[model samples]
Target: MRKRKWSSALLAASAIIAAAGCGSDDPGTVSGSEVYDTCTTSIADNVPAFYKTYFRCVTITMSGDTVVIKTDGLPPHNTYYYGSGHDKYVAFDFSKGSDYHPNPNTLKQQNVTIQIPAAPKARGLTINAAAVDAKVNSSSNEYGLGPRGVALDGVSLFNPLAAPGDDIEDEKYTFDPYNAHPTNNGAYHYHTTSKGPLELLKKLGKTTNTTPGQAEIEVYGMMCDGTLLLGCKELDGSAPAAGLDSQNGHVHDIKDKAGTVHFTGRYHTHVCTSIGSHKYTPEIQYYDTCK
Candidate 1:
């Protein structure tokens, strides 16, 4: 989470994307509360263990039945978008594949505010968790453009669709080694599998590897629809169940490797290309409205 800024002046001059700002952590910020040494912020106290323990680079709090997550939309990883003068900048690397190349846009600070259900239910199901219809939430709505979700490492999550005519399968060439790229507005995000969040989990002792299929466990992040995005294996280091849908998604009790159950019969999906060619994030939303 360490990014070296060239100078204080440059920090002051850096322009932020419009219409973004959030926080008011669990207990909210109180001046300068040490969060990251690379940068410091006065995050709130009493924050939920989910946000406090698993996430960074963002501020969060519980407001009624919702988890109000707010982030500046910048990832805590090296990439070409950080700009040459910035420390997070690593020269454009197309080494992973010949198709890799830099995009025309540069990274910019994003103003993003995302609100999701604290306890989610499938769209066609009643709040009581009983199915009433066959209609499921569509990716065209919940997964629409702009901050669809947030990665554990404080990055945004976008869909696989590219800019109108472009193909996301090809646009990935523009992504950094972390498997992420910025949009026209400069917000960096992930649409496919990436080593970024896995690396974070590694540092936290949550897993032993960062490689997708090989990683002991791979939990990308949550979508706005309350869909848990997972990779090759389930959070408990077990194979996904037998009833996954076309998108490799299914519902069951969610547990960490330690066997601590988090959610019951929750909807989640695996998107690891190495596991089976499920290369893109789920395009369909299984849950109801995403705040």
Candidate 2:
């Protein structure tokens, strides 16, 4: 699949003003103001199957000229903003699906409402009565595949509009789509880190400790034989049968002939933090190319 670029118009309209630069100590600068006009963007394509339950029939409500996001009838989803120029990134915790359980049958047909402060300096946004289920089928990967591995065949990342002076690395970062982890049923889920939704909170200038609401590190590439390579910590004990452990900044050669990837790590549950010295035991699944 071709890479997609976030619309520049949308980015410009959604950009937030930097308050820290003005020596403002107020954390509520962005509370309860709708600056940007409310617009809806569909996640049906961008969101992987693992996150489908949370995204299906969802509508994103953006405050005019501000970064606040509201949703209707969707699972608790995090919103992150990576600032441009000299602006620092910030994340907001909207709601958690795990804590609130709604009837799946009713939720599927319900309409949810999310409200954020208007733009420029909106704050204290609240999401209310959004009908949704926190039931993330632990049995399946976020994707719909059953125990069989989910194929990465159609996935690719590239810039749609590359100018001569554009930084290649930046373009890659913007276009690259991370691979999803497979569940015991071969279904795939979009790990929080891959989608850039949640913002990562840093402690004392350290990149390792991520505070909830910040973006999780992205994992890319898979060995033909099923070894998963990621940019985060290696929570899984030994490397898979093939491929390099990119998580630790070390590259390994592929040893398996089938090119099947395996995620032997534990799922980090922190909303804005990394897995700190924790061991991970992944649920196993296999994927093949979609014909």
Per model, how many backbone clashes are there? 3, 64
The digit string of per-residue lDDT tens for model 2 on 56-99 reads 22333233422121233221222122222312212322243232
Candidate 2 backbone clash number? 64
Residue 25 accuracy (lDDT) in model 2:
24
Per-model TM-score on C-alpha atoms: 0.79, 0.21
Candidate 2's TM-score: 0.21
lDDT of 1 at 117: 81
lDDT of each: 0.69, 0.23
lDDT of model 2 at residue 81? 22
